[model samples]
Target: KYSQMPRSVGGLNAAGEWYVLRSMIPGLKDKKVLDLGCGFGWHCRYAREQGAQFVVGVDISARMLERARATTHDTAIEYRQQAIEDIDFADGSFDVVISSLALHYVAAYEVVCRKVFRCLAAGGTFVLSVEHPVFTALAAQDWYYDEQGQRLHWPVDNYQQETLRQTRFLDTDVVKYHRTVATLLNTLMDAGFRITTIAEPQPTAEVIAAYPEMKDETRRPIFLLVAAVKPV
Candidate 1:
């Protein structure tokens, strides 16, 4: 099941990609953009669709890069396989840099964040979307089928100050670095990006209405959207 999860999830075209694309706040017209950690170029295509003049996407997964390249044939889009910890980029190279649902995978997230700081031109934007710390907090707890349908059998009780753990998906496991809101904000500030805006997106009202399982007793953030700027 873990092996299938990667494929079934569309190899990085996951739902977080959807939210990232939506949170990007248009302004991409003719911009020099970088899609960091672009798996399978799913969100890369969305960036192009939004009107980036030059979009360079970097990912470490070669298999995924091949698929992304094939799907996106535009000359404006370039996909490369590269590690995020150390990127192949010059100083002040991009007008906008974005990463979707990929930052937390690397333990040395600060290194990449600094690399992003170096890569952005002055006044450029850095937009990122991460799985909410809350989502990571509730992972692998317990789910049960009630009389009606599937629901949680236990309470969600792990939001205890940004602990990191290796989460397993039935078969395969990956480490998830849970960061507190404070931790993230401090990291960006130290990395030289000033926070401009922040958002925690909720599931569509339709989803909550149709499925009782989707309803939240209290507010739980499942996604986070952040926009920061490199000072001129």
Candidate 2:
């Protein structure tokens, strides 16, 4: 029996990624939804709860899909092991497409944007969240802390350098691509998506009170949320 990691509603990710992403989701009732990098199928289940007609959850990790399958009992939801870079759905296949904390890992975001635009039906919604440019600008991806272990400030290095960044995550060496805010929104516009909402999420006071570590997140944005739609 494989159990998922403990995640709190007020955790670092929930305060930023999930909070803003959830807010951007339009009415999903009877909608065909696609979730990219849907680890553990939390959002897939969420869409089902909101009366989505069908939900497809895609991820690169088979282990994650396995756990997601174990946790989900809905016939309306399907899980696929696929990388975001290789996502290929039929044209006009879905009503809502969402990706969270996944685009930064893909090298060519523009390619994915074009594909998304091509696949979504007219009036379809595309919502995504990525590590903020400022957060990913520094290769270190950490806050400046004093010798006494107090966080001094967050650093922004090479903000204009849109390139691959080598960093460590989950004790594993990982490579992530960095892009400026302008590039992100412009890519959507170039792909014919009308940008609807952009958010630099802030942790709520209740979240900060419960998770003191999130207090530092207020000083700088950690995640960027964007919502766009294909013109009908």
Candidate 3:
């Protein structure tokens, strides 16, 4: 797939709200970090900056990883070309595993979830940020202006789950799979991690003022964070 993932894929944000997201990470000092589906290695680079002994960025795209390596060679971040379902590390190898805007790409959720569970050390965290399922399903086919509303978004019809075709960053049309919040929880539990927290992130007022796109999502959560831990 020669898709241009939004610069957000690598940077984890187009508006630089990653620092806010990064705050959610418990701690990285002296940890072994794995940035799975690490397009362009942005998070991997940041992990090193946060004092991880080493940061490994794994991505399926060779071109994207190439650029990541070129831009981050001096930062002690390593890039590997690999799929999430088949990571090259040993079982229970990493202290922290994170994926930003990438988990949705895994069509067979169970297979990948198992991979994540097996890779984490006992009591390690699996923190990830992904598109909010509720907002996505609502917006899948309907587009209306929200000129006057109490919340960031008001659901036109809360019951319908529609399929969508949209252009990726490369401007190529792509298909996305939508799973509700309930399904997400069930999937994680089925995969063996103990779900710890599920949050629909709200952007700061400053960010909302700077980017109106976030306003459409803050109340409704266009993105959600999932934090889970592997059992001992």
Candidate 4:
């Protein structure tokens, strides 16, 4: 169900993430790229189409990797079954690193940031999208609903308290780590990446018109997109 979400069509991803995240990306011509949590190899394939020299997609789920490999037919693209936290590549290994909606699941985002910083070549770009802190701060991971099942307002609580949050998604219990916007930005800066851009994406009027359910997204940010660069 997660993969089946309306993504990559007309440059929109779930919660309108890719709509903004895609614009944050730098050029990929002849660049070596790494995609963390590359479910179904969407970004990997995109990188190759953009003339990337090589692309490596890493995801912990074997099933995800299998699906990615099946859909990918390029020799220059490789899919690896590995957790983002455990990824170890030589220093200056990639010209670009991208992660979509993945970092919230990582308990040690700082560690992964450091790792990404180390692997990225100087002047390389790092772009990522994760569940917004506001959306994950509360255990419910949802909005306040009226008795008639109408969403009133998005609830946010204990935003400063960073910890693991257990929530339901796709009918499965999922654990995600919550960090404030400051913490998320600081973690990347602390890893030696220069803060370039940050976005709390909201749906376009056209998107809201297409999907009326997304109208409530204006009340709160559902995803956070960050772009940073390793200095040359």
Candidate 5:
């Protein structure tokens, strides 16, 4: 599991997908930032480094929080142990809310979206990334390989069906809820957020060259990113 391994912001975990997500983020200076499912608090520290007034990182895992707290030396950052769905904050409590590759584990994304809308100030940004529906629609959630160990094709099936999928990851059966791209967009709109950007980013040529295995990422998007704003 990623939690068991040392995850650096510079790591090539998702074929340099984090760089695309990080680039979309607006200035955080003097802003109060909230990070949902902030495993290991990497973004929390990032927020502080960007001169955010205060940063809060919430995750469900105690072990993850323990590692985050031990590693983080910033006084402006706070780590909380809480489920993403159970997060409660006052109205307009934060200037920005960000979630990275975390919403798929949440079955009730609509509820969380509503909460994020209420918690964010007017015109506040809500940026998030999730496993793409095309990737998650597969029950196995893996690429099919040829008999000679060459890469085959990424198979996608049952795309319209929004349900729980149990896929293996790092020898553990991880539960991820699958939702179509339409549903993902509509849910945010229903929560009264104005869509700003939708991205299916491809790896850069430099990144692809650095990691040849990531060349397949150019063929199909494995992640989806959306940035929305609460209307004033």
Candidate 6:
């Protein structure tokens, strides 16, 4: 789905949202970083370029790790095949952790949150993004369309219902867990993380002008970004 998007520090995505997520990342110099659901290791390579001491990229897909390893030549970076829900690291092993569009796939987000807290160093930051609950709560993730095939409204139902949703993307049906905003925020707090920032990013005017089809992005947020820190 992201094949033609612009390359930023994190990776490419529709609407250039990666740039927004990248902006929330703290300095990487001398930091040890871990990326859960690392996909193609784009963020791992970016961290190495920013002078990270070491970086580990973990993904459930062997195919993704294969491509990541093939494209990455830096000795400071390592790729591992691991599911996000089963991620394990020694206490204080990493200075930062990041996940993009990955957490929604896991059923036990609270468990993963606790693990991330344990793995991070004191004052370490965890930055992540996921499909907005509003977007996922809708049936089939579909938008109301007029006879002319124009989008009329973005329907949001089951706002309070947290459950598994099946949606088709990239010619495949994928399962995603839908959780309310309260659940997401409270999960971090329950895991002892200090909430720092939350964002519902929209395409910038420049981006919309370049890709007119992306203008609808401004109508509703597709993704939500969250940043939290472990207390020192």
State which candidate has the highest lDDT. 4
| Model 6 local distance difference test score | 0.87
- Residue range 72-183, candidate 6, lDDT tens digits: 9998999999888898789999999999888999999999999999999999999999999988997588788999998998988888989898888656789999999899
Model 5, residue 194: what's the lDDT?
A: 97
TM-score of each predicted structure versus truth = 0.80, 0.93, 0.81, 0.95, 0.94, 0.94
* Runs with alpha carbons beyond 4 Å of true place in candidate 4: 8-15
| Model 2 lDDT per residue over 6-110, tens place | 242223244444666888999999999999888778889889999999999999989889878998999999999987778888999999999978899988799
Model 1 lDDT per residue over 1-232, tens place: 5225432344433342344346555488888899888887766777788788889999988987887887788998988888878686999989999887788777777888898999999999888888777666655634445888755444455676466667875666777777777777789999999898887766455544544454562355666778889999
Q: Local error of candidate 1 at 23, Å?
A: 4.1
Candidate 5 per-residue lDDT, tens place, 1-232, comes to: 6754324444424336767788778899999999999988888888888999999999999998998899899888988899999999999999999998899999989999999999999999999999999999987988889999876999889998899999987788899999999999999999999999999988778777766767899777899999999999
Q: Which lDDT values do the candidates have, in the order given?
A: 0.74, 0.87, 0.71, 0.89, 0.89, 0.87
Shift of residue 190 alpha carbon in model 3, Å:
2.0
Residue 14 in candidate 4, Cα distance off native in Å: 6.3
Cα lDDT of model 3 by residue, 30-55, tens digit: 99889888987788887887889888
Check candidate 3 and list the clashing pairs: none
lDDT of 3 at 77: 78
Output the TM-score of candidate 6. 0.94
Model 4 C-alpha lDDT per residue in residues 146-186, reported as the tens digit of each score: 99998889988989899999899877899999999999999
Question: lDDT at 207 for candidate 3?
Answer: 61
For model 2, the run of ten residues with the poorest summed lDDT: 1-10
